[model samples]
Target: MDLWVAGVDGCKAGWIAVFRNLKDPAATRLHVFAEFPDLLKFDPPAQVIAVDMPIGLPERVGAGGRAPEKSVRPLLGQRQSSVFSVPSRAAVYTEDYRDACEISLKTSEPPRKISKQAFYLFPKIREIDAVMHPDMESRVFEVHPELAFWRLNGEAEMSLPKKIKGRANAPGLNQRRDLLVSYGFDQAFLDQKPPRGAGRDDLLDAAANSLIAGRIQFGEAEPFPKSFTRDVRGLRIAIWA
Candidate 1:
């Protein structure tokens, strides 16, 4: 079996992943896994897995949250808000939101409050951070769908929001689909509705990240922080596009 490349995004239910055999772009596949470990069960396994989630976290709060997030925020401009401040490892390990916030406040140098949004994603963040080993850095990487789309759109931030309420055919959705189509994604696949738990944007985001994964596998992608820092566990915290 040919090794495949995968892009993953966290969803309400679990994770939505887009997999493609680089040798045959037309053979793209979508899958939903209940846990991060489930994603590693593919037959040949994905040689390159680009996921849109915070991987490496700081032991204590720094001037800016994570180095990778800081570098990409400016590039995103209008969409910078999409990048949430990642809590420290201590905060992520906390069981409750209040506890998480308290841990963040104590761990941060200047002290910071952990957003509910960031706290909600703690489980997913912890999931990756737990399994990611130093040896897997070459194959598994961090990526942001918005940044990937920005690069796909010639380095310009997308003008339209990804999710539009009460409108099935949003322009932003079409724009993303069109961009992916240009990169050899099948229109049929882009048009496919996500399963019960996943949303349309989740699929689109995964697809975009998958393209980034392909680029990375082929040596065509760039990392946000030219010089990245690793956590105490030896996990590199950098976003690629």
Candidate 2:
């Protein structure tokens, strides 16, 4: 009985889908959240939780300047802050939490009461925080050294265009997102659905990135950041086991 947990981060809320047994497509659960409670109820055994968010920041965020090289801005335009700079493209859609951060600048818009930070990372931070709770902590980090590697080295595999880096993933972009979602399913069940569109597709891509991280941590693949740890914008998964 393998367990796979997948999540998609939308503008205002997120949609989480859980699948068991890669062989059985029908055995899946999808949860939509407007708030944090939606993620609380179930605690499956031996599950891999994948998330989309920046897990680390530039050295400026901390006292010591010990961030990794990969997270550093390119040498050409290095002055920009290394902290997860909000994607300007995502700002156009005011509904997405990522876009909500930039919503305050519109001259015609009236000031909203929500905190911008909360607009982006609220219940998410809470959900992760809850994992630290005594009851849930054991279920999460007991046997996850791979995830520990991610915390120590936080950069997406697709740091730059594949052309520049000369690194590309298999199944290509066409089925990448679906493959990611499918990763959450048990090894027996596999899916190859193509992403429907550009926007939601990004969500799927993020999910896949989480899956990639999980694979590395689980010893299914080689672990990256061989020598040191750096931070990037994404979720953090930690397990002691």
Candidate 3:
């Protein structure tokens, strides 16, 4: 029996999902979902799903976002900038960016406001947050692509980045692509142009998440903070790789 697993990444169109058979890494399929719930309801359900999005919502944020984000940043080296400081739950729930920033400043210990990058992700973050709960840990896990790459690269951070000044960096992308190839993914499949509404980076990121999904399914991956925390909503606040 081929148990399926998926690695999902949020994109402008929606979510880019990469599904693969756990027993056969070469067997893969890519799909884009306009909504988060639809991804869960995908045909041939994935037994485990590792997504590159925040899963927990903390009521009061500490200095570097949550424990998971804080823990993973040190391991990412230069890529640490890719990890944004998540705001408090009240801030994340706000509709206006300014209001969200105000709430975050009031709720955080050091009075930090979320970045524009993080603000842009609020909708997708809320989208997934709305459907996730504590019990879903068995079937769904939070993953970070950089952290996954760190694990794949013998615990060393990648020297290049996926983007440089908002543009895709070919060398950096190839560096990641090479890692995926070495991880047993089919190059041809990975090389396929991303489906409409998604970017090349989105496809690669979803592919990276797939590896983490397999790791979580097999108990090969560990959460950033060995001791995980829970949000006010009981959702587990941890990043796995």
Candidate 4:
């Protein structure tokens, strides 16, 4: 049986997904979706999906971000900053940045404020939140690309970043690409221009995530926090890599 799986990442268009067959690494599809749910409707159906987005949002956050973020940060070392703090559900749902920060301060312990960068992700976060149901947790999972790369690099942090100074760095990207190539992905395919609305790095990120999806399917991938936690909505609040 050829089961399909997807690795998804948020992109300018909405989401960039790399769907691959568990049995055939060469059989893959790269696409940019207009919405998160559209990935759900993918052809041949993705039995497993690992996405680079926050899954569970707590009503009150502690000193670090979610347990998952805190749990995985130590593993990434200098690369840890790639993991952003996910605020409370109330803050995420709030419209204005100022109002959101106000709500977050009240909801979080030690009074954390939302960063503009994290605040900007609210729309995409809400997009996934609105459509996510607890039942889908069986197939859908949360992932972090940098964390995935860390695991790929023998549990060590990547010396190069995918970007530097807001610009794509070839050496950093090729370092990641080399890792995926070692895992059996074709370099040329990964090197191809990403579909409109997504960057090449987005393509590579999605590809890394797809490999994790396969691991999750085979019970090979491990969850951060080493334990599962759920939110008010019953969504699991953990990052898998």
Candidate 5:
């Protein structure tokens, strides 16, 4: 059976979702983003993992003034579609992965630019993702790269506002929190027993949706792309798997 794992990160932090047998449209597992270790339970299954964040940087810049600096961007848009680039920072530093180079030339000036690759841990996920696409059918031992939103509905706008009525204490977003609740109620059927506290329910919702996105991408469920669009409620949307 096809398996899907999805991770979502917003302004503060995020959650993850896992869906099994998308073809059946009923098998799934959802977890908080911090609970990746739990994935060990299922062993190896034909899987696809999607992450919700920028995968690479637009240019290579020195980090910590070290010689081991790397290229930031891992994918580039050609005309209208995005394509993968190099697998390593050093590989792109020498123009070896010219195919993955961004069409626009950019420079990182001092002061405005950061000085450490450690700070770019999140950005490097793109490189990891570049390495994952070839085996979308492969079972991953570690957390892989991919997104849950587009996987479920294909391309659509994601507008997660910064404030919420009952979840003001929860860090990050109002819209996204609402979305989580919606998913929990409509998709996961957890609406009746929502977690207590200010943002607990919201977090649960996010985790559930992220997992659903994973299942959708794993081909366990059919995506209704024909009903979706690029933008919704003024938020820009992006998809990478």
Candidate 6:
């Protein structure tokens, strides 16, 4: 039986995914799903799915935000800001931004406020949080593309931002594309522009994450917090790479 692994990243259109067949390296494929659950519809389901989204959310705000973000930010160094603090469960369930902010302020120990950027991801965050179950822990995991790239770059954070525009060529995007090429992905495929709503960086990120999922399937990946706590929903709160 052929084994498959996948990496997913959120995009303006929805989720962009990269799927790879472990037994047949040439069988890599790219796809777009309108929703998170749609990813599970593959004929030979992905044995491991690593996503670039916050999976486990905190029930109440701690000293910082989610523990995974705190643990991962330090390792990212210059790229630390890429790890957004996940909102608490209460805040995530709140529909209004003002209400969410108020809930976060009232529930958190240190009253950490949700950022506009973080708030923007609330719908996607909630979508994953709602669909994930404890049983899916091993099969589905959380990853950060920046951290994955950092690991691939010999643990050094890339100096250039991954989404710079207006240049003839983006060094950061090229650097990541080069790394993916080294890992056996087709350069032509990786260089192709994404669909309408998805950006080039989103495709690269999904590709990187798919590589991480492959590592995880082969027992080569590691989680951020060696010891992690589950939310009320039993989702493990940690970032894997």
Task: Please name the candidate that would achieve the greatest lDDT relative to the true structure.
Answer: 4
| Candidate 2 lDDT over residue span 163-230, tens digit each | 22323333433344333344344323223332333133333433443344345345553322234343
In terms of TM-score, how similar is model 2 to the real structure? Answer: 0.41
Question: Which digits, one per residue and each the tens of the lDDT, describe model 3 over residues 30-115?
Answer: 99999999999988999999999999989998888899989999899999988887788889889898998899999999998878
Q: What tens-digit string does per-residue lDDT give for candidate 5 at 1-241?
A: 5544443332223333434445554544444333333432444432554443333333333322211111112221111111122123333333222322231112322312222232334333433434433233233312112223233224333333233443443443334444544544334333233323214434443454445555555446432222322211221123333
Q: Estimate each model's TM-score.
A: 0.95, 0.41, 0.98, 0.97, 0.39, 0.95
Decoy 6 TM-score against native: 0.95
Candidate 6 lDDT by residue in tens digits, 1-241: 8999999999988899999999997788889998998887766799999999998888787775778888888888877878877778999888889899999998888887788878888888888888999999989999999999988888888778765343333787898899989989999999897988888989999999998999899999999887988888888998998
Kindly report which residue pairs in candidate 3 clash with one another.
none
Error of 3 at 48 (Å): 0.6
Residue 32 Cα positional deviation in candidate 2, in Å, after optimal superposition: 2.1
- The candidate, 1 or 5, that scores higher on lDDT is 1
**Model 6: CA > 4 A from native:** 164-169
Ranking by lDDT: 4, 3, 1, 6, 2, 5
Worst 10 residues of 1 by lDDT: 161-170
C-alpha lDDT of all candidate models, in order: 0.89, 0.35, 0.91, 0.92, 0.34, 0.87
Candidate 1: residue pairs that collide: none
Please give, for residues 1-241, the per-residue lDDT of candidate 4 as tens digits.
8889999999888999998998887888888889998889877899999999999899899999899989999999888999988999999999999999999999999899999989989999999999999999989999999999988889899999888888999999999999999988988889998888999899999999999999999999988988879999999988997
Model 1's lDDT to the true fold?
Answer: 0.89
RMSD of each: 1.8, 10.6, 0.9, 0.9, 11.9, 1.9
Total backbone clashes of candidate 2, pairs 3 or more residues apart or in separate chains? 21
**Residue 34 Cα positional deviation in candidate 1, in Å, after optimal superposition:** 0.6
Between candidates 2 and 3, name the one with more favorable TM-score: 3
